[model samples]
Every structure is written in C-alpha cells, then in structure tokens.
Target: MKPLPPTLRENRRYLLLRITPATLEADERELYFAVSDAVTALFGDTIAAEVHTATIVREGEYLILRCRRGREDTLCTAIATIRSVNGTPVHLTTISTSGTIKALRRGIRAERKGNSIICTINEAERTGILYADEKIDLIRRDMKGQDVVFLTKDDMEIFHATTTITDGI
Candidate 1:
C-alpha cells in the first residue's frame, strides 16, 4: 500500500475555539453534533458535507476542529453561531487557527512555574481564595508570560472560569 501524494492529499485546517460560561462538561460527541447541526441549519447539509470535517476534540474549554482547507470560513462561522450545547448556553470564541497539527497544539504564551501557570493577582506571588459569588474577569495581558486576573467585587450569580491555559491546549 502507498500513501497518497502531497498534491493529491486533502488540505486540512484547524480551528481553536473557547466555550464560555463553562456550565457543561467537555464531550466531543455532543460538541460534534452541535457543530454539525449548526452548519446544517445555517447552510444546509450540502455545505456541511462539503466541509469534510475529519475530527473534533474538546480539550478543556477549547474545541479544536479539523476540517478540509478552503472551508475554514464556513466552519468558523458555524462554530461561532452555535449558541448552546446540551441546553447550556455556550458562547464559542475563535482563539486561533492553523494548517498543521503541530502549530495548532501550541497554545497561549505563558511562563510555566512547575505545573500551574504563574498567576499573579494584586502584585502578590500568592493570591487569596475566591468566593462563590465573585466574578473573575480578564483585566489585561501586560507581558508575554504574565497574566493579570482580576476578581471583581461585583456579585454575580453565574460565574464561570471558561478559559484556562494548559498543556495540549
């Protein structure tokens, strides 16, 4: 048996997306169904079949989707438009896209201190605990390896840590 030639082989594109309001757990099958349904509903089955999606993986809060090249626009649009999964409202935000798996595997830029990310809150090395009613929002990314996470004093009912910088992300 022989592998297909480079020219004859299909070109693939990878899309990185984040699911917000992390109320639901990561399930690839359900995510796939949601994405497929969204595409079908938006552009019909013809376009969905044409997209030639190979695989979909849910890593943490990120959903990495691999599909045929030249169809990234369609796939990205479908992912962005998907409102809910398993009755939980999830907002999908595109993080990055790549043509190769190696490139796609490279995630957020940060400095690693042992295992966990070197998170600093209020200019302190060790921050305090978070309350159940607290809302942690992104203040701003000042440097390449430093991330400033602000735990707002606002009392919010629904608070979700939807994004996390991790391995294989």
Candidate 2:
C-alpha cells in the first residue's frame, strides 16, 4: 500500500524530555514500555489508544516522543506520572514541544554546547556541566565520581576562580 500523502496524514507533535541525573542508563525499549505503562495506567486504554505515543529518538540524556497533535497535553501528563524506569528512579523533564523534529534537534544541539565550564572547587579545577533545571554536575579527575550541585546559572560565583568558601570560613 502507498503511504499517506501529507494532506491525508495525521498531525503529530514531538516532545523533548531530559532524563534527570543524565547518567541513568536505560534501553529504548524499556523506556518506551515505561512510558506506555504510565499512559495506560493514568488515562486507561481508550485515551492511551488515541494518544499512541511513540519514542522516536533517544540521544544521550534526551528522548523525543511523538504523539497525535491534539493529544500532546495528554501524553505530557502521562509522562509526568512516570517515576522509575527498570527499577532506577528518574525524573523526565519536558524541555520543549515542537511540531517538527528538526527544530527540537537544533535546540538540543544548542543545549549541549554551552553548559560546560571549567571552575575551581576544593583547590582543584573541575569541569561543571549545567542541566536544564538549574542543576550542575561537577566532574572529578578520574571521571568516576560526580557531585550534583543544585544551583542556578546566577550561582556560578560559588565556584570562584581562586577561592572556595569553606564551612569554617
């Protein structure tokens, strides 16, 4: 059978979700199931069938979900209900919703480019990468240990170039 023409096709919307911690590794299939379950449990079979959410892209800590255009809100609400994936607790923050994947991908590129900076912490220089929700992850020398610091973009001063405030100071 021939594919449906643009005018005959159903309208769809794409959602970009940022996986919290940015380190919790999850499989695409597993993630899809988790989302499907959330939608089904929260809205029941009828709405779930109408939404027909699908995970189209999974890049690093980001996931692109597609659903019928009008059901975007419903899908997002279902996504908010998800608490864990494969036993790992995680929070999926909806970064943006777009009508086209190209636009969302462009935003993701810009997002990944500028959040990193070199700063001094504990007299040692570390690389800090900021997340969408005003959180920063400082990478250690060995890259084995990372500390999540909850701070906004304006709070970068905490990691001063030459000095760090100590508890006793």
Candidate 3:
C-alpha cells in the first residue's frame, strides 16, 4: 500500500483520542486536559497558545473538543474586536439586541422546519438549546413519551434532531 500523507497521518493520530465515556466527572475533565496537553506536546508552543480558544462539547454521554487556531491576521482582528467592545455600552447594546432578534427568528424557523434529524456529536458538542452565529438554530435532543422539554420558546423555531455518539479510541 502507498504511504499515507502527513496530514492524514496526523489526523489519524488525533482521531485516536476519541474514546468511550468515563464514569466520573473528574475523569472526563482529566481526559479533556490530557487532550489539550497532547496537542501542545505534539505540535509545540504555537498550538499550545491557541488552545484557550478551544471548546469542549458534551452531547448525551460523549465528549469532543474543537480547536480553532487562526493565523496572525485573523488573530489580530479577533483581538481588535474584543478590545473594541470593552466598556462600550452603546456598541454592546446594539450587538446584543441584534443578536437576540436573530436568535429568536432562528428558533422559530427551526421549530417549523423538521423533526428528528441526525447530528454527529463530537467532544465539543452542546445539548439543550443552541444559538448559532445569531442566525441558525438547532435543537439537539428530544426524547419520546417523556415530559423532558429540552427547548421552549413562544416566538422561536424548534427543530427535532438526533445525536449519535461514536467510540474512537
């Protein structure tokens, strides 16, 4: 067989970390830390610096971590955006109101859209209600025959979706 490319090899190694769920919360935290540490150890200080922006998502019993490391220009713009928003009451108010309206519309649309759609659950997943980019709205879980109301909104869209948790390691 031909040798795998370097990127594929690296991705394969990364995929190895996705395994079965731990029984304890501490174990889960430890696993997350270990994954963060491993990324730093394998990719050096640059990768380590970007780890803070990473998010660990939990869907049902599975855990996944998503990392986004940007280039210099992207990082600079992000920093600038953060700094610009600091202590700016008017700007903050405008952003907040716009975001809230967008989220409300998305929720309403999602509710009217579909039911029981399949979703891939990685380590960085979030359950209950999810508001995305102040636009798209997705409801992650809905159990049947149970009084479990995962999402509720008077003027929001609600869509049904299923989450599939897979073992990696």
Each model's lDDT comes to 0.64, 0.76, 0.31
Cα misplacement distance, residue 96 of candidate 3 (Å): 31
**Per-residue lDDT over 1-169 for candidate 2, one digit per residue giving the tens place of the 0 to 100 score:** 9988999998999999998756666878888999999999999999999998899978988999999999988998999989888866778988899999999887674434326655566677766665566555554545443344445555666655432323220
Which residue pairs of candidate 1 clash? none
Residue 37's lDDT in candidate 2:
97
Candidate 1's C-alpha lDDT?
Answer: 0.64
Clashes in predicted model 1: 0
- Ranking, TM-score, top scorer first: 2, 1, 3
1-169 in candidate 1: lDDT tens per residue?
A: 9999999988889887776643345488888888889988998989999897655677666678888889999988888788877765678887888997668768743322222222343443322223244444342324453233545434222332233333411
Residue 3, candidate 1: Cα error in Å is: 1.9
What's each prediction's TM-score? 0.64, 0.66, 0.26
Ten contiguous residues with the weakest lDDT in model 2: 160-169
Candidate 2's displacement at residue 154, Å, is 15
For model 3, residues 1-169, the per-residue Cα lDDT tens digits are 9998857642200111122111113344554455455445555678556544332443322333333423323222332222111111111010111112234222222222222322323433433232232222233333531111233332233333344332321
lDDT of the structure predicted as candidate 2: 0.76
* Candidate 1: worst-modelled 10 consecutive residues by lDDT: 110-119
lDDT of 2 at 160: 56
